[model samples]
Target: MTDSWLPTLLTETSEEGYALAVRLSRTAVKLTQPSAEVRERVRADYAEDFGALIAISHVVATNFHTVAAANGFWRS
Candidate 1:
């Protein structure tokens, strides 16, 4: 298991950047929750929540936006 993460969000492609964004959110959860058991316990809380899912998407989109800007909108 990787104990540490986050060495700049620089990614070579938009797909990779989007993946990183999701990873960033998951990492934040791990850092905050730290307990896998607790996280699992609350999984159902938002498992079928439409608003929660949208919020998650917003967070990922925001991170991807920054990455896209850094990559000059992926223009050639």
Candidate 2:
């Protein structure tokens, strides 16, 4: 099952969420290996970046809103 936040963000046309999803999905696909051992090692490398992505998404969303507001898009 997907997280509740995912649909809400997606429906709101959240570019940050979409960008994060794309990055994570690409990482996941790149890590696919025939050996479970190699897969675990790959996941270990990606786990840290995964955490960073969460933080970065929040920053990106905040910036997005700020830019939108500056353009008077939020006044509507």
Candidate 3:
């Protein structure tokens, strides 16, 4: 076994990523409310941001799986 920081880093990154996802989702909901101004530019920006959040979530999930497999946390 080699001493590598990847596992620790991945754990921290996943935690922060989850926090970011939650915050982003809250902001998206607030922005999309009927009372909020839904201009074309704003709508486009929100869509882009939401897409980025989804990407981040995917990366975090992938990292978690990698870490689990590497640490022998999964059973056959």
Residue 65's C-alpha lDDT in candidate 1?
89
lDDT for every model?
A: 0.85, 0.53, 0.53
**Between 1 and 3, whose lDDT is larger?**
1
Ten-residue stretch with the least lDDT total in model 3: 4-13
At residue 59, candidate 2 shows an lDDT of 56
Model 1: how far residue 25 lies from native, Å: 0.9
Could you tell me every candidate's TM-score relative to the true structure?
0.83, 0.34, 0.36
User: Candidate 1: what lDDT?
Assistant: 0.85
Q: Weakest 10 consecutive residues, lDDT, candidate 1?
A: 1-10
Tens digit per residue, CA lDDT, model 1, 1-76: 5655777667888898898888888888898999999999999999999999999899888888887887787765
Over 14-64, each residue of candidate 3 has an lDDT whose tens digit, in order, gives 455454445544555566674555554466665669787687577556655
Lowest lDDT sum, 10 consecutive residues, model 2, at 5-14
Which stretches in model 2 have alpha-carbon errors above 4 Å?
1-48
lDDT of 2 by residue, 1-76 (tens): 8664223322233455445455545444455555777767767675779776786566556655554554455345
Which candidate comes out best when scored by lDDT? 1
What is the Å distance of residue 47 in model 2 from its true position? 7.7
